[model samples]
Target: MTRLTLPSLAALLTLAACDAPADGPVQDPEPAERLATGPLTPAGPAQTVTADADVNLQHAAAVVELDEIQGQGTLTAKLFGTAGGDPAMNGLYVHAAFFLSPAEGWRVFRIGDVLDYRVLSTGPGRVELEIDESVMDPETSEIGSRTRRMILGWAPGAEGAPPETVTVTPAQ
Candidate 1:
């Protein structure tokens, strides 16, 4: 038997990230594609929500949102239930989703009454986002069920997002 060392594993992971589908868009995702087109296998640890932060209350229906980006801003939303109707949301529901297929470009994945997508991943005009698990229904299958691999095909920052700001400090 052969075993891969740490360096080998790291190298493989990095390569996978680069091959990840970014420019792709979800024109009209198919049924089967929904399941397979998941977990890009190259994303950072997504922070989980526990019914706090911005919004809450997961009713029988999901609450979706299309974050309003100003210029180069990042859409950061919160997940978790407050005090609502449906208690079934306690399970592993899609709190949020970030879809972007070769055809779609960069459209955020959301659930609820409406599909409020938010662009996070950036590539020339794209960005990476940690999709929550509040808007997922592995049981539902209605064709346009969800934006599995959706994308944003238009002028960068079409959402009128403002220039983003990030504070960085070097470690000793």
Candidate 2:
């Protein structure tokens, strides 16, 4: 038979003290105060507007705005074949990236890519997209599903003039 040492006996006593009587009633503490009631009221009055107020508002808005590309965009490059053919692939699929203007760099995209804005469909000379600008949930990383349509098209022009004139419009 093993004899309990002083330290071991003290540890056992400590553990026994920690455990509540099994037959005792379990009392749950009262529910916490409902901290979240409804939309919170602003803490103070709105800031005074000044001549530069519009500029300040624009600067704040720009932080969340999507980078807009010019209308003269094109499906300038494509990636095909197996997954290895493109660095942006998720699996075996490959997709095309575009250039809004020849002077602008490429905007890379892959099939079924969902972003703040997404490419809904793509074809030879046109690309359709949906953009959402609603508030997002910080906890779950979810955003409202409301969206607006955007269509991009390439129009061919005569010689000596620009070969392509890109147009961006909302889908009817």
Candidate 3:
């Protein structure tokens, strides 16, 4: 056996620790091979997802379901007190608001106003929301308003779907 110098020994150790070359022929990546198998088979099936991917996908779908509700128009209508309160004002305010007006903003509408409100889900199949009477001095508007949560139905019944109407009255 030949005597080895420190430098030579270090170099030999480095070579021995290097990663090995392909055992034989280069194999196709799992994903690529999966894709080549058949159209019915998913190249990257959810079942085979890494723990991170599974967790992230579960969260991402929930977010998408949540975001779907913003599309409906703004306009809220709810019969809070009594149905016979006023036939004319019976339906939603003629004008509707999809999004809530600023904490204090004014949108004028006739009492008999009818507007399509986006209903929100409160419980399974059932829905509920409170209408807050924004800062509207009674002196400014004809009728004083109050905000109360009104239980309503979500039409076409589906999770995360918008409501048929939402009711908003100026704060009393």
Pick the TM-score winner.
Answer: 2
Q: What would the per-residue lDDT of candidate 1 be over residues 45-108, giving only the tens digit for each residue?
A: 8887675444433343343333432333353323222233343332323233223445653333
| Model 3 ranges with Cα > 4 A deviation | 1-121, 133-142, 154-172
Q: Which tens-of-lDDT digit does each residue in 13-117 have in candidate 2?
A: 999988857777876644453344554579988988656656656634433223333343333443221223222222233233454456765454443322245
C-alpha-based local distance difference test score of model 1: 0.39
lDDT string for model 3 (5-29, tens) is 9999999988987866746998767
Give the whole-model CA lDDT for all candidates, comma-separated: 0.39, 0.49, 0.40
Which ranking of candidates, highest TM-score first?
2, 3, 1
Better of 2 and 3 by TM-score: 2
Off by over 4 Å in 2: 1-115, 134-146, 156-163
Candidate number with the higher lDDT (1 or 2)? 2
The alpha-carbon deviation from the true structure for residue 124 of candidate 2, after best TM-score superposition, in angstroms, is: 1.4
